[model samples]
Target: MNAIIHILQTQSNGILEALGQHISISLISLFIAAIIAIPLAIILMTHKRIAEIILQITSILQTIPSLALLGILIPFVGIGTIPSIIALVVYAVMPIFQNTYSGLTTIDPNLEEAAEAFGLSRTKKLIKFQLPLAMPMIISGIRIAMVMIIGTATLAALIGAGGLGTYILLGIETNNNALLLIGAILSAILTLIFSALINGISKLSLKKIGILFSVVVVLFGGFAGYRSFVKPTVNVTIAGKMGSEPQILINMYKELIEQDHPNMKVSLKPNFGGTSFLYKALESGSVDIYPEFTGTVLESLVKTNKNVSHNPEKTYQVAKDLLKKQANMEYLKPMQYQNGYDLAVKRSFAKKYNLKTISDLVRVEHRLHAGFDPDFYQQSDGYPGIKKAYGLDLASVKTMEPSIRYKAIANGKVNIVDGYTTDPEIQEYDLVALKDDKNHFPPYQGAPLMTEKFAMKHPEIKTTLNKLSGKITTADMQKMNYLVTVKHEKASKVAHDYLVSKKLLK
Candidate 1:
């Protein structure tokens, strides 16, 4: 119950922000669709054959997938919210166009006769009688389009367009169930509220259904208006590791600023890269701040994860020294979580060949199937080196996304799978992970890296992020990740709830 309250308090602002973006995309597209559709409908009324052909063309456009549409548009239009608006507008055209035409055509024959008998001009009859009568139907069509777009616009986050979908996508990727559940709950609520608002508008304007819609356009003219024109405003970018865990952490940082450090301007960019790539971005200053595993930095960055001196303190020290000297980066405090690499297998397979470590696979590796993400399969620290170090020769290896590979293993398509130690599915799927007794891989401990420039601008950014370092135990992270990816929650809620539950923030 404490966890639930913490989530609502922390993520409510982000949910509102996402709602704003979702509504902006939906309303703008709907408005544009009405402009295009209404005219087309009027022309179709005048020229029936041409309208049929135009409607058929729009029908075909509606069949394409939203993701696919975004993909096609990305190469030409590039990224951000603009491309999202265009795709949604295209999607909206068919419904709005059809409804407008139907409403106009279905007007009472007697009304037309009355207009004609009154000796009104064609334009006058159309505007005074036909248009007013069609208002309710037109509004209904727009309402349907609005609802459809609200749901579909959730897809906008895929191409870096900010919306509630950002949380949803990342939650699924990392297997964080809390993140998934909270995201769903918030998105559902927003849709229902927006639907109610629009319906209220229809009732009030159309004047028959006894519904009243009072729309208040709280226009935040721009970012300048949202922000105070005071001195000492700080700009900070906090990037998370790709998927839900990172997204959640970033959102937590944002909430912290809003709650305690309103003078600071916090901008979050989640899913920067895998643990290793984020290190590169940090070193190069392309990214200002990012979350990472401590063991990962110790091994991949400092090259210090070894069979000897594998303790956490020594690992953190070695990594800290390396970052200070070579990368011009600083670590504030470690996070509560320690996400690490894990290896999984079916319960039957682990028992069958006595597979307990990297070395054990050598005995029956010939008959086993191996699976990992395609990128993980080819990395220098991946299977190639594992083969050389442990002599675990497998019969075959397959590559797939981290999401799909677990299913592959569960279905018996593969006997062995690479997994994140913090992933919840490792527990839910009841898979067994072997210990790397030989210490074949390096450690991956998480820390936030901030550029020297960013540190000067926003000191609070480092403090807020670093507060979470070393906070999440392996099991805790695994559970959070499971809720995100497997259960379909939201990342912002996951991070916020986790922090609040742990008393890191109010």
Candidate 2:
């Protein structure tokens, strides 16, 4: 609890920024869903068949997994706020639409009849009678949708739409319970506050409700207009894949660039999904730069079947050339570290098994329970490569999130787990990384990846970032990761300290 309070105090500005983003996206999504669903419900009151079809579609949409939906939308709409809001609006629509329709359709028959007997026109009857009666139900629907939106909006951070989820993802990756608690608790509090606010609004008179709605519309509209037309443009937007290493690297990039060009505005989007998401963001111009690994470029991005040389420089050269020729992107000079894949086990377990190398794994393969992150489990250069190279296959394999797999191995839930060479958990858990005797995994030197056009337009930015070339070593990255993940230090501060220690920054 003290740790949580300390983090809250230290990170208050970031928390508030994330909270503002969360509120903006959630409210906008709810408002848009209301605009779409309520009017459609009212119009469909006279068209039951059409209404059923539309509602069924919404129900089907609601059943689709949120992450899957976000992935599908990325190709068409790109990432960040737009795609996040669209996905949220989809989820928010069904509840609002269903309740509004039900409220109107289920009005007391006698009261409706009395309104009709008073010679009220359809429009006048809806305004004076049906709408007022249905207001409570509409508010109830909005409340439900608002709560849902707030909860799911955390995921917006994954696609570079800044929100409270940034802390959540960072917390998970770094194993920081204080950060995780902050995100979860704040989200819960937002839910309660919005729910209570809706309840209060539900008790208001019709005139007051109308006035309140008008105010909301105006406010949302003004906010939208300001974002679209008035907001200052960010000169450089740098992003990173999930993990403390990427976050730290991007912070280094940001600091170096800003130090060189003090007038330039740079935005850092940390924990911005995985390699594919960041790559796509860069390709689509959503992000100007991100840290990427050479092996990932060869194995995942370019998908070349050509044999990659084991030499670090050769591998980076091949990746750099391929990216330039095929994708119109440039891969900058790589750092000295090789954050490649490795299989790690508890030191005691390794000692007991007499495991010293990848080949040694074959002896214990039949008894080993393996935990792996989804990427390592599925990628050819990952588990499959190990199987082919070392002729090793474990007795059981479970694919889990990257952060959870570390815990699994550390807690003895699994005998072994896939890990990166520089992962701080190797030290934290006292795990021994078995040598890759067969040299199955290629060198994975990290570098800044960006579009050639952006590089050309901002040549000075490239020059500024390349100052980090060959600067950070495996030990440096491991220590930085340890500071952020194990000690719960801020990634930005760690990056800044590293730069100052190296005399790269004043």
Candidate 3:
């Protein structure tokens, strides 16, 4: 409880900012859904067959997984608030459409008939009679949709749309229960607040409702216009993939760049997703820069089948050349750390099995229960490479999120897990990284990556970033990761301290 309070007090500003974003996104998505669905429901009233078809399509859309829908939309719409809102709106439409249609169709037929008998036109009858009678049901649907949107909007954080989910994802990645609780609690509160507000709106007369909606629309539109037209002093967006390392590294990037160019503003999207998401964001111009691993650049981004030399410099050179040639992205000089993949086991377990190398795992392979990150489990250069090089195949392997695997290994839920060489959990959990005796894994030096066009446009920024080249050693990174993940220290502070210690920041 004290920890939670301390965190809340320390991060109050960030929490409020995320809350505001969450509310904005949820309301906008709900508003858009209402505009599209309510009107369509009205139109479909006279055409039952068409209404059924449209409602069915919307139901199908709702069934599409949220993350999958977001991924599908990324290339077309890019990341951040737009894609997040679109995905939420997709989920919001079905309930609103269905409920409105049903409410109108099922309204006391007598009332509708009387409105017609009184010489009312179709549009007049809809406005003066049918809509008012069906108000309760329509409000109910909106309420349901609002609640769902508020909950799901948390995922917007995954694609760099700021929200409480930032705290949630950070908590999960760092094993901070307090942070997780804060995000979940806040989201639940927001849902309740919106649900109650919708219920209040339901009680208003139709004319009042229309007036309220008009006011809201105007406010929303004006805010959107202001953001679109108003430029920041000098804005540069930097994003990072999930994990403490990326979060810390991106903070370092932000601090360094801002120190060099005080007039410049840096927007950070930390724990923004995995490699593919960040790369796509960069490609789409949604993000200006991000930290990336040299090995990942070669293996995942470039997707080259050519062999990469084991030496760090050679691997970095190959990745740098390929990224520039194929993707038109500039790879900056990397820090002096090889955060490559390694298989680790509890130190006691390794000692018991006398496992000193990847080959040594062969003896215990049949008995080992291994947990791996999803990417490592599927990538050829990951598990497949280990299988081929060491001829060790674990009988039990479970693919899980990167953060979960650490807990799994610590709890003895799994005896072995795939981990990065510099992962803090290795030290936290007393795990031993077996030697890749056959050099199955390539060196993975971390570096800032940006499009060539952006690099050319801001040569000074490039110079500012290059100051970090070959600076952070493997031990330096491991210690910083440990500080953020295990000690629950803020990433920004850790980054700043590291730079100050190295005299890179004044």
Candidate 4:
């Protein structure tokens, strides 16, 4: 049930957009393979030994893991959709190439002998008779290649190619079954439709329908390739707590300035990573824009901010001042979203203990088993700080990844879990995000920071992003977050829903 809802949500936010990315990789890769392989296969059939060696070599490329192969290609091809498509195409080669080779070579040698006996030229024999007869097998190979490419294309999602695999991976990271289901179902549906199309074409006379199918594949594939890899100037990467925020603002920018206003390309590159790493990526210029928190950037990155717990607007002002002088960045308008850190226990346990705030935990702190993410366990902003601020000393502290700790709490393995106040699971499982009465955690309001140059060039982007500011309350952002990170719902879908619910997307 959750899975179905999740799929519907992702589909809403350009699930077709992701489908476009994945299919583009598959179709283009397969098309290029077809062009290269078909001619080579024809030549190989004529000259036996070289083709055997080449086919064997191509088979080895198929065995490389798609992720590893793509990683190796990234340095040379750079990022975005190109390296991904190239890798998928390389993966798609063997079956199609071999099939082409097999289709041409396996023909009853007598047909060629007869053509030779009739004094037909070699080119005429291939063009008139051989190519037509090889259609069924060649098409069969393409069909297999297409199916293989679809599955391999999932790997491209890891490299930011953006596809159904994005949902699949997010599901895995967060243990969201709905996301896994959405990924599986979408991929299955696409493959089924494509298979039917290929089978339908094969049923048509070899003289014409095959040409039509091939042409469509080539045209769509080529266009997709040009769009994904060739275009996309001015990249902006955002991740961690602010992972989905850019999707909203980016689409808005795409619609308004890039579409409504023009001649400026804005690529909102989303990178999912820990806070520290995301900061590093931003500093190095790997990301042009990121949705970040006001207090976190101040406290964690620039310690001169006096650890002052200020309001959202004040924090943004502080961030703007600090970022300009230090990081040369600008914090745009902030959404009414705050992702403050919080602690949680199972709902039943909380209810039984009447635990409402951090102070309440002091009485039972020693009795509870606390699990915190590794980074949070010892960091000043993590478990250590929470314990220091609340004065609640626990009996046992287990340091694990955030996802693992959440799972532990969910399964009753731990009585306490480190949590984000805005995490979607807090609402989903009804786990209470404790009131930070003592003010232990810093504020992390959802906000975007962009390069000064990009900002000056496109004022409309800031305007588009500013629309989302204050549009989502902390609780509302929590629900959207759950719909994605926990529920395995698509980010685009979650964003679209929030937009529609608010009538932002009429």
| Cα lDDT, all candidates | 0.69, 0.90, 0.90, 0.71
The clash count of every prediction, one per candidate, is: 45, 0, 0, 3
Shift of residue 259 alpha carbon in model 3, Å: 1.7
Candidate order, TM-score descending: 2, 3, 4, 1
Instruction: Write model 3 residue lDDT over 307-387, tens digit each, in one string.
Output: 878889999999999999999999999988889999999999988989999899898789899999977987767998788
Model 4, residue 115: C-alpha shift (Å): 43
Candidate 2, residue 125: how far the Cα is off, in Å: 2.2
Least accurate 10 contiguous residues by lDDT in model 2: 272-281
Global local distance difference test of model 1 = 0.69
- Where's the lowest-lDDT run of ten residues in candidate 4? 238-247
lDDT of 2 by residue, 1-506 (tens): 99899988888998998999999999989989999999999999878899899999999999999888887887778878999999999999999999999899999899988988999999999989788899888998999999999999999999989888988898899899888889989999999999999999888887898799899989988988987897776899999888899989999998998899989989988888767777878888888999999998998899587987899999999999999999999899999999999999999998998999989988888889999988888778999888887888789999987888999987889989999999989988899999988888999999999999999998998888888899898899999999999998889999999999999998
Off by over 4 Å in 1: 1-159, 163-168, 174-234, 272-287, 298-309, 486-489
RMSD of each: 8.5, 1.9, 1.9, 8.1
Q: What is the lDDT of candidate 2?
A: 0.90
Model 3 global lDDT (CA atoms, 0 to 1): 0.90
Give TM per candidate.
0.57, 0.95, 0.95, 0.59
For model 4, name the residue pairs that clash: 236-269, 335-470, 336-470
